[model samples]
Target chain A: MSVDLEKLLRPVDTPLPPYPPKVITLADGSKMVVRQIGRDDIPDLLPHVEALIHHERDYYDIVSVRVYAELLAYYRYRVVDEYVLIGQINGELSAIVNGRIYSPEIGMSYHTLGLKRGLRIGAHCFAAKMEYHIDVLKQEEVLIVAESPIGFRRWMIEYNLEKKFEIPHELGGSPSYSLTREIFNRARGSLIVGSRPVPQDLLDEAMEKILPPSDPPKAPPDFLAATRAKYDSTGTSIIADPKRKKVSHA
Target chain B: MREVYIVGIGITSFGRLEYPLVEIASYPSVVALQDAGLDTVDHLFVANMGGGRINHQTALSSAVLDHLSLWPAGSETIENGPASGSSAVKLGFQAIASGMCETVLVAGAERMSEVNQLDATDFVATLTHPMAEQIYGITLPALAGMFTRLYMEKYGVTRRHLAMVAVKNHGNAMDNFFAHVHTRVTLEGILDDRDAETNNPVIADPLHFFDMCPVSDGGAAVVLASKEVAKKLGKPMIRIAGVGQATDTHAVHERPDPTELTAVRLAAKRAFEMAKIEPKDVNVAELHDAFTILEIAESEEVGFFKKGEGHLALERGETQLTGKIPINPSGGLKAKGHPVGATGVAQVHEIVLQLRGQAEKRQVKDPKIGFTCNFGGFGNNVVCTVIKKEE
Candidate 1:
């Protein structure tokens, strides 16, 4: 292939400040390490993310498909200014977050996918992605959009995101909702979590390899599959979390 | 009077059921019939709390019997607040015990989730005294919070004890396939840690998020028959040895001692006397743990532990899956979920399962006696049942 043709196919990549990896204690007192991963790690991450494409509820199907494509673009050097952050619990993939630096002042949030659903895995991972935009790279705002009602509720409503309806997002023309530094700051103490240094052993294990998700979210059997979604709709029903997932499913 | 025995038990897992309120009752009716290998019963007792109020359907048993194609059998709806389940059991027991019917099916169900949370809470709040409590917006959690506060001060039970109850019940529920609660919450995550505040915020003062049972939609049933009928069925012979129901002041404010669940005490005493057994004879028990505090308080009220020492026993690992008198192995209301009308019947179903040695993973050690106390309206109205394994 000609150098000119290859250059035409891939957009120019911009230098991004590296994200400092951190760890957070989960509800069960287990530690989860949230750190950056590169395109080279996609081979390990793809098959796992691919497995969640059928989690029909909470729009995980569409989200997983979009996430798979975004990672593929990153792998082929087709997307510009892209960064991927992986959340691991003892070397297994828990969540993956990706976003891109759109310009000097603005950012584009691509997707946040959780192979594991509860324990706020996606919430924690989404916070890390926003942290990259408004805190790490110091972008003025990150354009965000939600494909699922859960995402709409958790991200758009929970964060009180501003409607940047005038702006279109990369995930297609769902008018974007934006997370500003002020909005990010307000949620930092409560929503944003995890600690830096990540305990050397935890970091060593997480970086050694992106292992498969131990219990990945699967297609709800039939349509009315006994799901964590029903189990999660309220607090008293919170028993549907995976610890009880087996009994509930069985 | 003839002795009544439960020859068949059936239950839909205690959680959300999108089915109509009637189906919640009928689905398990069919299962109970199948379990007994009986196509029909002489009578059916349907227990429900919010059918008319929440689901906009009244005369529930009529609908259930018709739906199950068990028409022409005598049917009635028994409504007794949250005690509807066991109250239905009592009626079925009476039917059999009086020789009015040799075989009866008592099914309990509630579609409480059909209404939104606020309306569902309001529907249940209707159980409170209208002028004294309901008019003032007194929800169950608010009432339990006050009760827990006074009990805590009097008994020195701490937040740790409540968290311990939540933790233990959650773990127990993991083994119960039909239990409503699933997650295993640690004390560190929901209590002692930095995120605990946000994670387990105070639903009521001293009663954190995990303190209360969830409002669920489910159904459970037991086929009660005469001893001869039970023996003929050739299923496990678990006798409904005793049943005791008692009511107190309709309003908590009217009671001489707010902390004492006198109804629970009296009801349990009556049940034990009738069963010819003491509280200590009960090898496995399921106390109503609608709020985590109730598990501690009811244990004392029912004589499982001395007053003020229920938490001590809880701390000593007495309530674990293999504890001395494992309570709420079905997870009680806290983890198993409380589908108001269905809970009491579900409790009796659990004890029957335990007595019959059919309670799979959450089974207690070999035991002869099991007891259940279904506390209703913050202990204003209570029903206690004792079931013994008949060798």
Candidate 2:
């Protein structure tokens, strides 16, 4: 249940400096605070993942638990450079943003399916992941390289992410697009990265330290029902404002 | 106002057919033309709700007209979801009543089985509010199931009461040769059928598969002609005495009560007012029984019974073929199959059959007046038409 991400981040260890947390104002005037993922944030992150899956049911095909385990293992054991952020509203996790620093050698393995196919799919995927990486890259002044699947070359054009070149004979028939720091920065302003500015190196380190060193977690029995029941009964409410008066800035 | 009379009515088997979209519609259109004893028609109104999504084809009216070799005449496609058939009928009625055309052929066709069940479900779900319901995985059946549960909770109705509706409709459909699914389904058979493969499995919660209508592929056509032209055709005519169409809010959440279909009540009121008769005046009625529970709900909405009494009526066999004011003697959508766009027109075709006293075994005895309730998007839009046998 515990994860130590410090070791993975040790390579890029720098003094933790003060930075404003990302704040997203919801339609209901509720504000969500975004910060880089930490070892103690699993419980907070679980609900967001569940909600996302529930919302995307009719739209996207999600990966299986086995695939998710593999991705987590790869991040914990293999990938030492990545980024992760969790958004919290009223002290409860509301969303998650995660990405890895992709090299041509490592980029050929991301699984894609269903509506996520097509050439541009890779670029969009890469852009999404890279945006998270940039959130962690804050003040680091480090160059990052990532590859997008073939067909996603237009994604390179749209984001103005310069194509370093394409990889041949990659996953399926899709090619890969390589992006550098300069192009990523140009595309950064247009993308809604939300409120988080963790160093990508720190996120990568944290993920590596926290992942289980051995086999995957055991399959939970009726986990969905159990979780839903727990949510219903807990009656725990996140307090937003102590005062009854609504905050007005007009 | 110019009087419009239905000179011809043609309906294909109200069940699954192996024919393609164009073929299904063509059969009924040809039959209607022959029934009307007409070599030509001035305008054609094609009614289909799912062809755009199921068949991936738009502008289907032209496609059907071209396929039937009735081209060069004005053709239009009318879609009001499941009520497309009734909408087409309204359009045709208006065309002739306005003196724009002497003869107008209205055809309703739907081929839903071609698509996979999940895809078909998703397509139907799109009729709901995209941001609110669709995003939450709410579907038509899910809403129907909710309404069924609420109706039962509020009215003390049991599942057995709902089962009687399917049993009655299926038995009635057995007498209907064109019925898509006709079999004697018992309350025990429906409640105990656990195997999804053998019995109609549960689609949405509280709604077993048997409780829902089949995704049929069929068509029905009615030829509307001016009174002069109908008299010359020398066929038994069914006078469309009154037609009323009304609308309500599309969002189910906005409605005051989910159990009662307010639009149906309003439309039926208008139709009865126009016809200068009451619900008692109609000899028979063909309601939109897309689901077993819908029949119960619609019956009350149409003022056929007191609120919350529809279930009791079905349980007592009051809505059966031999019952008072027989509902769905043509097997209804539950047994006859619901081809969406074709369902409303098929209701009209059944009323015509009842009025003409030609419904064979399922015919209501001495039927003089008939009523058809065609609904769109769960009572968001409704059209009720009253027809009478002409002397």
Best by lDDT: 1
Each candidate's interface RMSD (Å, one decimal) is: 13.5, 34.4
lDDT of 2 by residue, A1-250 (tens): 1245655543442233222455433322233344555435444334333333333222221432222443454344444444445444445433343434444223222332112111122232334445444433432212222232222323444555443335442324334454445555765533333334534553344434332212111221221121124433211111111332221111
lDDT by residue for model 1 (B254-344), tens: 9998998999999999999999899998999988999999999999999999988999999999878788889999988998899999999
Which of the numbered candidates is closest to the native, going by highest TM-score?
Answer: 1
Candidate 2 chain B lowest-lDDT run of ten: B192-201
Q: What would the per-residue lDDT of candidate 2 be over residues B1-391, giving only the tens digit for each residue?
A: 6888988788777654656776677667766776776755789999998888888778888987776666577999999998899989989989988999888889999888787556777777777777868899988899889988888899887777777888888889989978887456665445532212123445676787678887777899998888888878777978888899999888887888877788999999998998888998888999998888888888888888998898888877788788887999988999898989899999999999888888999989998889999989978999999998888
In model 1, the runs with Cα more than 4 Å from the true position are: A1-6, A77-80, A102-110, A140-180, A218-250, B53-56, B112-123
After superposing candidate 2 on the true structure, give the runs of residues whose Cα lies further than 4 Å from its correct spot: A1-250, B192-201
lDDT of each candidate versus the true structure: 0.85, 0.67
DockQ of each: 0.17, 0.01
- All candidates: TM-score of chain A: 0.86, 0.41
Displacement of the residue B165 alpha carbon in candidate 1, Å: 0.9
